[model samples]
Target: MTLRKRLFWLFAPLLVLALLFAYGLSQSLILSRFDRQDAQLLEGEAVRLQNLLEQNLRRNLDLVQSYAQWDTSYEFMHGQHPDYLRRNADPEALSEMNFDFMVFLDLQGRVHAEQWLPPTLTDMFVLDGQPPRSLEALRRAILEQARGLIQTSDEDLYGALIAVQGVPLNLAMGSIQDNQSTLPSAGTLIAGHFLDGERSENLQQQINGTLRLLAADHSVERWAPLPSPGVFSLNRAELSQRHLPNEEQQQILLRFSNSLGQPQMLFELTRDRRLYHEGRKAIAIFLAQATGVSLLALLLIYLGLEFAILRRVSRMHQDIAAIGPDSSQQRLQDRGTDELGRLACEVNRMLERLEQSETRDREILDAIQDGYFEIAPDGQVQAVNRALCNLLDYPAEAMLGQSYERLLSREDAERARQDFALALANNEQIRFSAPLRRGDGSLGHYETRFSLIRDSQGHFAGFRGILRDISEQVAYQNQLLDLAYRDSLTGLGNRKAFSEQLRHALDKAQREQGRLALLYLDLDRFKEVNDRYGHDVGDALLQDIAERLRRTVRQPDRVYRLGGDEFTLVLPDSNSVAAQKLAERLLAELQNAAQIGALSIDFVTPSIGIALYPDHAQNPEALIKAADSAMYEAKRERNRVDLFHPRLLSSSTQSG
Candidate 1:
């Protein structure tokens, strides 16, 4: 064979192999992108479905609370009104309100009225072999369950997913309180939503996906375990050609547990993999066409090749290599309408595009608030953007060529070096936060994301990173957390913080067999102080009292402001004697005149009440209620310390 023929045959086979490899690589890339997109879509849809279910439950609770607060419903619960069920609990009205079951119970646990959406399901109840003769019995059962729930929780309104007769229902119960006065609940209203096939269909329509109501069978092992109560969990089938017969198609499963932490439902989603198959088919076709075109092009090039053409191509390659970032005006010499000429022109165009893209990238980096930087594999700074210079309080010229340690403390610099080594060794990205030392000697908090740079041969070349100053963001978050737990006026723990402390203290006392006491204090004539003096003086006095309480209490014994002039002290490992002594000391200190600026105020005596854990009450709410009763008793006698006693509850109620 001639020389040209030998060259054509040699290059043709290599081109075909390259085309096949490209086809396989393209298929892998396309499949990866599709997998990620499908997973994200599945997770988003799962969240939407969970939100829908939660919204339905919230809507039912709001409806129940609204009706319970109405004058007619309150009166009906208080009194057995004539035709109350017929007027208000009508089936049509219940259906329109989207309530599956609603029951009103008096304080004595007598069911006044009850209604069900699907009237037939009421009689076909599967909870018992024989359905109740009257709907009143079922209503009473629901009310009893609600009462049990309320006794365990502090909220006047609470909800849970309850199973009755192998059916799931979103149930919420609320106190039927007089709108004008909420104290002394007149009755309670129980509301529910039966998760039947129709409701599932409605949810499917809203989400545009199939909704399967899996049986809450804990025995049936799931691929993806149920999430924590009220949280949604998502899982997708592992992408593999060796899938099972039923799992040939891509599938996603979403599972969420009810408030009771039992498996509520599993939603199986079948994703359309048609695009993936089509993409592979298209790549195969392109590879076949490319292979054939490569042979023809090689044959044509072999025929056209001459010593002069080879020399011109060599010259063009040299010209291309000579062009650099500073040589923007350089262009390839276009000799004629030929392949080499067109190739040379394309190279020039590519260079122009690269220059424009580099300018655009620099502009983008400068516009960002975060610092952008790159470092060589040896840990030397290669490039620094304008934002990075501003972040480190250094000029770009001074920053470039310096070690990364320039912007970090010695300890942090060592940490960064270790992290960089790890990223390079493992060929992975790393993220960390550290204190950054600026050029001005001041330190600021920064978070950095470092990605390893690799060459075409997959060897570690350098590191590129983004650094963001998060000092303000972190400070603001801390401020928000403090505000949530601390009282604004007294800087003491607020009601929510106090509740958490009390619960923890009670648990500790019970677990360790130790004593715990809760002291409830009501400043005598505090309202008078506010009325006689302005609220400013009253607030100052409260602050002073809070300081005194904190000073009097021993370490680990916290004081909390429970709104208004009410305060609570959680003292772990304390008995009646110690608690009484501390209460007396608190009263004595509070009675001492409080100095608010130039003003001095005396005659502030507190009616203190003490309740011991495991003696007065077991839980926080009961303990607080016991202490409140004793506090009321002390208030009547004026500035006395009263320990919680069973008789105090009735006596204080009678007096009030």
Candidate 2:
């Protein structure tokens, strides 16, 4: 081949390859953009679903609370004849509300009067023989603890409801006035209600109407009754067997509580996403068409220029041979009326475009602060900006062609892999936080956003994402949370933390049918100590006492300084015997003398009051109050331990 022909051949393949490369790059970019949009849409849908669920739950709770306050319901539960009341009122009005069953229980947790909507002739009684297996153990335990309005349910009672049970104040007060009795009165039944199919259907209709109004512009493909407890799969089985999975299928689970204060309603929502899918497909097609047209134009230009300028310019290159390094600006002059002159003009234009593109790319990369990296399908770092290298404390040359995972800490690499796998499998974006290792062997916390890179065919290729250093922000937030929940003086849990811990301990104890101990400790001469010594010395002494109490207690025990010299110790799995031992140890710890400067000061022993779970009180507040009263009694007796007595609650109320 001649030199001119050889030049044409050499440039021809380069021109074709460039066209093909540009086409592939455009295709990849389009796919990535579509995937990101899809992920955002899914996240938005999930948030909407969560909000809807919360609204439904709140509405049901409000409805239940309203029914509990009704006069007729209260009268019926208080032994007034319901038949007489029903005759006086409209039965249809009563039946309008959805209620499966409403049973009034007496103060002692005994069933008295029962009312079932769509009244079943079969009588439902509160079983005294044994607690029903259906009710959650937690609810049963609550009923055993509290004397007033107790709402609970068993497995049989699937719906949510509000139970209002308390002493009939009107009846009890009247009886007390007539009898002139100093004896404490027993509690009486008041009222309660439940939600049934009629009520559920009514609520569902309201919600469906609201949703329809909110989605006015959008078409709702299907809205039907959610499945009840006993129903088999509604189209679920058929969908699972399909060869090509449907992305438009949306499912929602709805649950509501019954009148007996049990969750019952189980519903589902399957909405069609046909419109959403169609819109996305149309967008993809439009993008693909635009890319194809651009590629065709580039290919024509490459073929036209390859034969014209590349062939003729090589033959005339001898005229330009005298060009030295100092004459770098010299251009090749191709003399021809046909294609050579046009090809030379086109080459100069192409060079100008390349220079402009490079400038724009560098500007864009420099504008971003977050580290941006793109990895090839084989896990090699194909490209990385300056920000990425600077963030990882490495040079651009060092990062290019390196495994992207090598820049991350071992834990971060594992987490990144897991997140990438999740995004690919589910076709979603995965966001997570992990420690990124620096060159100095220290870890920096980074919030990473991982998205699966896909080919034009929608096949998994690799991942591309950005990393942000969120270590400072996370640390500040954690510090705020700690300050909010912790005691400033002793570094122990504050009142808020103590209450939460107490509730958790109570829940565990109730579940296990185990006893928990709440000990109220009052320093005998704490005020005198503070007055005699400076506040600083008193504060130091209190801190010392807190440390001693913490050391003396078990790991499971939680001690709280409830302001001043008063402290509360929560002992899980502790009965009266165990509580007494703890009290003795605390008294001994404080009875000894301590030297504060020149004065040898003697500390007063703590007057301890103990309350056992399900024995003294049910709730945390009640338990604390009961323990407080017992502590007062011990203080009255001069440094002793007092077990909670019901009479103390009554006497203390009278004294107040």
Candidate 3:
């Protein structure tokens, strides 16, 4: 073999290998893009499914509330009208409301009436005696929850999801009341919709996916009677034996919990495997095409180029050496009619095309609205787009060599560094929202997505990311939260917030075996002040009173305005004596003349009633009523504080 033959043999294989490597890389990139898109689609679908489940329960709550708030329902609960039950308890009525169970209970938590929809499912709700072994526990749980709802106010109804007999149900409870007639809560009306196999199948059909539910207690007997709940981790062979064909599907698990936040069930969604198989087929075809092209180019090079091209290549190098950055437009002098001459012309055209491509890429980078940045593995800023320079209030030259830490506030930089460390360890992309320091010394909120960059050998190179300003969105969310929980006039926790806090406090006290104090206050002669001082002054005085009440309470102790001249203070881990002392101090504080912008109001007094938990009442609504009754007693006496007592309700109202 001669030198030419040896060179050809070696170079030919090298060329083919390079082509194969390039094809593999391209195919990998395509497959990765598809995988990412599919994952995102699955995640979005999962969120939509969760929202649909929640909305279903909300609709049930609305239906139950509508019936519970009717005057006829109230009269029926109080045993004044039997016709109300005859009309509403019918199967047609229940089916129209999409309710599987409708139970009416008295104030004492006794079931007055109970009916099941599709009435054939009546066997599933047997709570009277010796219910089925599978449903007895669930029936008892539902009754316990219904009794608990009697303590809640009639202001609004709420819904929840519960599991019974290994089946999920949407449950809503409301207090039966006639608001217009001032008819008190006679009882509560509980309604629910059973989530059986058919309902689950309907949900899956709507989302175009396979849905499976797993018991949270690891007792799979109720659903599939599996020996254990570790089926999620079984291998393909093991799953096949169990008749679950998950080999060609991707499973996305969404864990759902009960209202108390205990793990209740796992909802698993399986998506089709078509995208993956299609990607594999396309990649194989690309590899085969790459191989054939590589061989063809090698054959042409060996047969035609070796002898004739070398002499022309040398001459062309000599001509290229004469060109410079500032050189005028020039063409090669040796214009022979061969492949070499055509190659020279193509080279010049390629250089011109390359210049245009670079310009377009630069323009695209500058046109992006969000800030884009690239950082070295050592955390130094390597490059940035035009938007980043403007966002950070720095010139490109100034920002290029600086560290990412400089562009952020101290706290944010520290947090970002920690996140970066975690990302590097996991070798994955991350997204987060945080406050960023801008160039104008003002703070802005940004949602940033950071992706890791790697070299050909899969070594970490650096990071690149995009930052989108979300200051307005964050501000609007916070504003809405404030409006929901804060009183417009007194700047205190409104009724809603106070209710939540009271519920939390009561739960904590019950769990820890502690006590809490509730104090209800009514401003004495408030109507006279509103009449004499005008509404504006009265409003200002109420604001002043709120401040005074807030100041009287210690940290973590809350004060709330329940509309009009009524206020309440919640003291966690307190006794009746502490409650009385705080109430007296609040009354003393209010006695001081409220001077709001030169308007002095003398002789402003508060009638306060003190009630202690686990002493006056064990439930929140009853505790509040006890304190309110005591406050009314104090009101009749004028300028006095009173403690809640069982006998206080009888003679106290007589005096008023």
Candidate 4:
């Protein structure tokens, strides 16, 4: 073959392979995008279903509570006894009221009375039948569950309403009877159904509708309802028996239990292969048509460019190769003003423009101190500048086409996703600070600006933003703040910070009508340590004592080094007994000799003074003075927690 023909043949296979590869990649990308969209839709549906279930359950509970609180029902429950059911009464009075069963339970949780339909009531008249016994057991179980739930639940009135309500009776009996004997006994009674057939039917309809929505293509083979007090259950079986003898079917079985742990409903959902196959066929046809169109377009472009441009370029290259540098002024002759001629002219201009653009872009990128990156919609890194690559310790080529999430620390990925979602939803910029993972497996804190990139049509295309390494700035600010408010020697809150926090705690306690304990701790013989073994040893001993106090107290309690060896602790929501015990524990822990280099320190008991807020003082300064006065008294008593006394406060002021 000639050179052009040989080149064409070699290029043909490569062009075909490239087209095939591109088609395959496009198909995969489309499928992945579709899968993500479908997953999001499914997740939305699940959340909707969860909300629906919660609303329905809450509504049902409210309805049940309302029914249980009816006046007539309350009267019947309180008046009717078990023996009264045996008395033969007119069936018309019972017929006037609509109820499948009327059960009455006393405070001791025993079913003392019940009324049911004639035939069913007669069947359970002896209470020996298996059905009646099972019914009794179920009722008792439900009552016990309700009782336990009410105990821990925040709904205090729910249990009280039910317990106070009376059951309806046919006529006024014994203690319930008054001067209302002239009232008709037939239609005057008020009897309500707690969980009758009508309510159960309505619930069943709702459940079936939900099942249809959830399992649209599946067939329910069998469904059975379970009975209980204030409970509903269903059993469902999928119809998987094939019409043809040789065919196989798939079935899914499900059992639903209520909060009482009783099996209330069961159902089966059978997968329909017809629907599945139809969906698959639609997807396959779509993929095939998409691939065919893409390949055909790519092939036509490749062929047209190859013949009209690539062949002509080859000839121009050979001519240039034969010419010397002296003949560089010689230009290729143009035949027609077709696309290839326009391309040649544009190529010359493009080269000049490209150099200038490249230089400008490089300067701009270099000038930007913050790390800038461009990410595609699929989260792939499209472009990362030098600063970013340097910050992450990754080469530009290595980082490109990598997932943006990989650049964030693993612990911060979820938070990053939330920020990303908010930015995308609002189509606005978001500022977030999180740790970015580096190549060396260390994390550096980065403050990033995430903004949604949109096309001209206003559709979200991707993201383009900058991230700055703010670790040093943040750390320096935190250190400065710590130095201002924290004790330099003991690493506890300073006296000023402690006083502010204590005042806030006192205000909160008074507003909430809660308790607050102020503890003033003055280390015994602490001055002697500084005098005997330098201030360094004293400082180390103080730090050790501060740590011991912190460990001995509850996590919510605050310990502050209130200058020198005197410390103050503010225990919110703590009583005097707890504070005294904590004080004793602190003294015990400090009594042990602290080994600071060669200097062994002992006799480090703290004279703790306790003062109750509102009981001792109304203001922060007054509370501190009261506690301080008590501390002096404790010191006089040789290291003990002295409850503040008015006499002691007065005496301490007089002495001072």
Residues 168-264, candidate 3, lDDT per residue (tens digit)? 6677888789956477778788888777656777887878577776665532322221121221111010011111246456656665544444555
Model 4 misplaced regions, further than 4 Å: 1-369, 375-382, 395-431, 503-516, 531-537, 550-557, 595-601, 612-619, 645-656
Residue-level lDDT tens digits of model 2 in 1-656? 76546655766676567656755664566544654455444334433433444444344334433443345445555666558335632344344433233344544666554343332212222212222344334234323422232333211111222221211000000010112223332223222232223433454454421121111112224433332322111111100111112565444433332323333223333444444466567656765675576567656665665565554666456535745434544555664666667766665566557556866886798679988777776778866777877777777788778886886778778876777677778988788787666766677777867677888997777777887889898889879987988778986778888889999999999899888999999988878877888788888777777888888888623888777788888989888998999899888877777556666668567899999888999999899999999999999876788999999889889999
Cα lDDT computed for each candidate against the true fold: 0.74, 0.58, 0.74, 0.60
Report how far residue 304 has shifted in candidate 3, in Å. Answer: 34
Considering summed lDDT, which 10 consecutive residues are worst modelled in model 2?
Answer: 167-176
**What's model 1's lDDT at 306?**
48
TM-score of 3: 0.40
- Between prediction 3 and prediction 4, which has the larger TM-score? 4
- TM-scores, in order shown? 0.38, 0.39, 0.40, 0.40
Candidate 1 to truth, TM? 0.38
- Please give the distance, in angstroms, between residue 626's alpha carbon in candidate 2 and its true position after superposition: 2.5
Q: Which rank order by TM-score, best down to worst?
A: 4, 3, 2, 1
**In terms of TM-score, which candidate is strongest?**
4
Locate the minimum summed-lDDT window of 10 residues in model 4.
Answer: 164-173
Q: Cα miss at 446, model 1 (Å)?
A: 99
